[model samples]
Target: MKRQAYRPILITDASRSQDDQLTSRQRRYVMMMGVRVACVIVGAALVGTRAPLLWLWLPLVALGMLLVPWLAVLLANDRPPKDRHRLANRFRAGQQTDAPAMSLTAEERPHKVIDGEP
Candidate 1:
């Protein structure tokens, strides 16, 4: 049996690639906002009802509302905020424009041998 040498795949320019990457804080802020909004709506519904669950819903709703400001602050305090333009420029500078498509070929690809070690 003959061994076949494998060549590495290279991307020449990555700047032109279209991809979305959000920082941790940004993702969290978005998630928190969505949850808060849902909570507010639910809470309002509970408050308007004469059901005994109003007690529970009101507090939950209030807590959710309270979280909005805190979440905003957290988002504001993010050490490195997400910047789409900057990230795009960086992608361009790094020559990573068109990213590879997600497929089994990517996941199942064999690892390259380094330093001639198996």
Candidate 2:
């Protein structure tokens, strides 16, 4: 039988929640701007006869386009940089666990051992 080696797991901090939130907010901002731009273009095309009315929507479309980048930066800055290990441990504690296991595995491990030592 081959002996399966069990090594100690070194868990590092990763802010998954913050990352997810940032991604979600970015998607929303992009979608919002896309929709607003499409609406403005379509509205202008449809109301070609009403020049003044169609022009009125341009400011809103411009504002939406301008706000996308600003809001993305704002939301990204708002997220606090927290220690991932501590955060995960806190979550595990709420679930009645002592220590949260780190997700790192041998395959995904980046550090290399030289001369038969770590």
Candidate 3:
């Protein structure tokens, strides 16, 4: 008998709470920035140690000093990626309604013409 993979079923919305997602992203940003700051300190140390290849170490130092902050800030400010499968401008959240969804384009697929309206 062939064994099938155990796939756990879960709803998209139930997968994560908004606050959890936000806090996780925030943690990632802080950790990455910390690493970037460490790069600068390490680069400075390398240059101070006068590692025979000053030429190589200098660029590393400059890169750590310059690019790291810019990238760190960009990542920190980055928003979560959009879900392509989800629709846009469908309806406002927390909406309550007893009726089923009514099709806005119920006029017919080919679009029939009325006698009075041109």
Each prediction's RMSD over C-alphas, in Å, is 15.4, 11.5, 14.4
Error of 3 at 82 (Å): 1.2
Separate clash counts for every candidate: 7, 2, 0
- Return the top candidate by TM-score: 3
**Whose TM-score is higher: candidate 1's or candidate 2's?**
1
Q: So what's the TM-score on candidate 3?
A: 0.54
TM-score of each predicted structure versus truth: 0.41, 0.33, 0.54
Q: Candidate 2, residues 1-118: lDDT per residue as tens digits? A: 2333444555544346766877777777677667667756766664776656656676665676576567656754565566665556556644775322444456654577678765
Candidate 1: regions farther than 4 A off? 1-22, 80-118
Can you write out model 1's per-residue Cα lDDT over 23-104, one digit (the tens) per residue?
5556777778888888877877776776686777687679879978697667755555455754564377547654343322
For model 1 the TM-score comes to 0.41
lDDT sort, best first: 3, 1, 2
- The CA lDDT at 101 in model 3 is 31
